[model samples]
Target: MDESLRAFLEALDYDGEPFGMFYTDQEPPSGFAPKPGPALSMELEQSGAINWQEVWGSFSCVIGSIWLARKKNTAAYFEAARYGCMGGSFYLGFHQPQLDFITHYVSTGIPGTQVHGERYLRSPETVRRFFTEIAPRPAPKRFCVFKPLSQFAPGETPETVTFFGRAEVLSGLVFLASFVTDDFEAVMSPFGAGCSYLTSWPLHYLGQGRLKAVLGGFDPSERKFLKTDEMTFTVPYEMYGRFLERWPDSYLRTDTWQGVRKKIARSRDAWGEQAGQGDGKD
Candidate 1:
């Protein structure tokens, strides 16, 4: 992590460290990989009972594991065939779901299959259109690694850097992102799975040669793994460097942001995040 960015985040009272995602051939240190197997089957959806332990042999939500990685200060990774969820697999460019079931599953129910719709979209057609428009890119390497920014070694570049924070922290991030570029839509909030925002869309913008930030964590299913107050801000590494260059001169340095910082302190104290720990700034 860059020292300037670190200090800026600290001053903002952002609680957690930012994490990075990258594709690599070699495994990462202390990385948590999805359990080995044939991957989840839709047949299990219709089965009487699912012994998930017998199925995947462990807890498996791609975003959930990423949460674990952040809290534990470790790394999490996924392989092409071993990604746990069919939706996550598709988003990660590992493979498509069987018979395009994700479309219906995310929208309307598939009648007679025990598959109740999540109602995230209006209809299956809407989901299909989403898939068509996004056109996620395939994984570039054998292993997709996610770890905290501090863990990244020299020569290892991350495709995306993801931050988890409440609205105040995100506000700083949003303004700083826009300060680096003239684009009116410097930050984009697209509808997607938590993993899609953290991984897919940021990479998508990078692949298209556009530098933009992605505001995410709106997925209802993945909210359980995130703090009640938290959302995500994901950006391409190049954009992150721009933030490093511009934040010293941005509004983040002004008394206006300092007023917001006091509110951040209050929120953290109310939530017990600063329990008994004096940051010494007070």
Candidate 2:
């Protein structure tokens, strides 16, 4: 098997169990972009009853090029080709039900799948540059960028924003944006008011979310409402992994982002106060 396939298996933790690797590119190898279906599914031959309570994760690996893989989770693998086969297997990707914490994945295959994820998320522009310059195999010459950078809340440093620390902070926010009925208080608590930084703008087609966009927009019908004029980017997962490599203990909470989150809360508080004062007779 090709190392990409082997490394991909290792990254997925595939234990030689009877499972198939489902693949569908986001864009065509040609000039046309890939119109990813809302869901990518497959049927497995009879193998008992597919376990419905296993883990389903969309992870990116960091091996060769950046890659995205969504592991089909089933405590029990389906039945043989057909024993008493009579069933329907189809569900919305978002509605499929999750067995563990939902984590973001890489759109491109990564070099090291065992530990890291796809490479695209690591350093968006630089990674893209790498693909253009150091790509082992030939690929179409199309590219994407994060919307917030090009436009929206303009007037800042050209290269790096002075405020934001890690781009994945926004990367995490991008993942949260996918939720329709998101709990702002709960979601914002982890990353802070940084949501305001990203939420106000729209998503570009670059970052890691490109592969399984099976769900389309986070809000489904939201494209009609262009909140901001930003390009949706496939997640630069390689950028994300590079971040983790640099900051090994990434799980620790950040006081800086916490402070930023608090400031947003304060701004909201101030806005409420101003609104109340405006209503009173002057």
Candidate 3:
């Protein structure tokens, strides 16, 4: 494991849930429990904060619904999906390398009946193509990736990391990174697996231009986690929405999709007009 990752693991509360570090000058909300760290800077010429709650809620609605359908447990799976959606947005997205590692594990690991597992098994070539395509893209120039830290300061608490950036672009990066790595086998392994979802939280404001945040996954598996590689991309929010809207039909049983749709509809009602809506500014 890398020294930074080792240090981060050492800092964990042990009893506390897994956590990732965020680097920013802004005073985070009380829930965020900001702590002192090295002063880092970035040049984000074209980035800004978007309505993260809306983005997250929509993502949860779609993804959660799918999980619900697959697991055939509306109550449990929906809650997990809700938790994942909120948690991912709160964290500054998953590290690209971590996401890639998880993808590699799933694409090459055992096959199963779940959507992610079966899909990869059906088209290993397609999965390979995806990784190849994303591997060459540069990390987001407008965002700073945070180091994962396990510990919270004496008074610090784990809370959402605010991100500032183009919602459409960030959403696309997150969605694609997630899509290619949705490996169920790793997730079901006794060793915990990295999360597939990513969120872009706002970190700080630098005069006219604010710094955006993007972090990666840190699971509690016994395996030693380390950063291996980096990849990033962007897809329009509208495009993501369309994909999510069609995902269940394409991958799930009709009966399951119908049941899941009802839950999604309820979530949409609660989140108002933005729930599951496209990334195009409302």
Candidate 4:
């Protein structure tokens, strides 16, 4: 294993039997006896049964990518693919329940079966065309900047801000923005906040530097509404990686969230204070 991969695996706190296999059915593999205890809810869960093959396929892809990276000495591409896997795993886990419901219940019902049957009955050419038409194109280089609607006085247009960063970071941001914007907005709206980033600014990656983007929503001020913003600031790449390591999951802690908020607040307040001093001198 390459040093990086070895280091990553070593850092994980795994306590399970080495290469031990656990089965929900049948006896454990030869030489291993089943642990005598009631099966946990997770062990009994059948939600993933239908998609077990897909799960294996994803696992193989991740492992194969790492092996290929080691063989080809292409660590950069491997790291990117690893990051992609993190996002892909989160997406699968999030949607697995709905898929299980559809497969077990919906597919058994008349209306659902008819719809699914019709879809399955389509010609290969038609199916191919359908997917081809709907597949997303490569993400473009773009992002947007946003502030509160209240930040601007009545009749004044909001100013647009933009920044350029590393290509990988920019692409990641664009892909995530497109993927999560709708669902994010839906979830955030009930709390009186709207997404305020995408369509307002562009994200640029800053390479292996001390630059990072903090994805969090601005807390509701007097208006009782939160606004999503991608706040960029300087932080070591290792620190940034630690944050991304938890991507699409428990990535941000309350402390990091509050820290970003304070950073932005400080920047804004400093700018306002400087402007006030200039006005006084005039």
**Whose TM-score is greatest here?**
1
lDDT per residue as tens, model 4, 191-270? 11111121111112222221323332331321122112222212222332342354344312235434544554454354
How close to the true structure is residue 225 of candidate 2, measured as C-alpha lDDT? 23
Ranking by TM-score: 1, 3, 2, 4
Q: What lDDT does model 1 reach?
A: 0.79
Best by lDDT: 1
Is candidate 1 or 3 superior in TM-score?
1
The alpha-carbon RMSD values of the candidates against the true structure, listed in the order shown, are 4.4, 22.4, 20.4, 21.5
1-282 in candidate 3: lDDT tens per residue?
A: 234434322221011112232233333222211111111111111133334344334443222222232223111111111233322322232222223223434355434633244233234455555444333222222221221223334543222221112222233334332443452221111111232222221221111142222333333321122211211211222323333344333423346444544554453444353432321121
The worst-scoring run of ten residues by lDDT in candidate 4 lies at 14-23
Residues 1-282, model 2: lDDT tens digits: 334434422322222211111112222122211122122222221332333222123111110001111111111111111111111011101121211111112223433654253332444344344223321211112221112221213232111111121122233333433332132321221110111112111111223233111111232122222212211222223322232233323221356545544544454354453322211111
Spell out the clash pairs found in candidate 1. none
lDDT of 3: 0.28
Q: How many residue pairs clash in model 4?
A: 12
- In Å, residue 146's CA in model 2 sits off its true spot by 16
Q: How do all models score by TM-score?
A: 0.88, 0.19, 0.21, 0.16
Q: lDDT for each of the candidates?
A: 0.79, 0.23, 0.28, 0.25
Instruction: Return whichever of 2 and 3 wins on lDDT.
Output: 3
Runs of candidate 3 with Cα error greater than 4 angstroms are 1-27, 31-94, 97-101, 104-108, 111-125, 134-282
How big is the positional error of residue 223 in model 2, measured in Å on the Cα after superposition?
6.3
lDDT of 4 at 157: 36
lDDT of 2: 0.23
Give the Cα error of residue 248 in candidate 1, in Å. 0.4
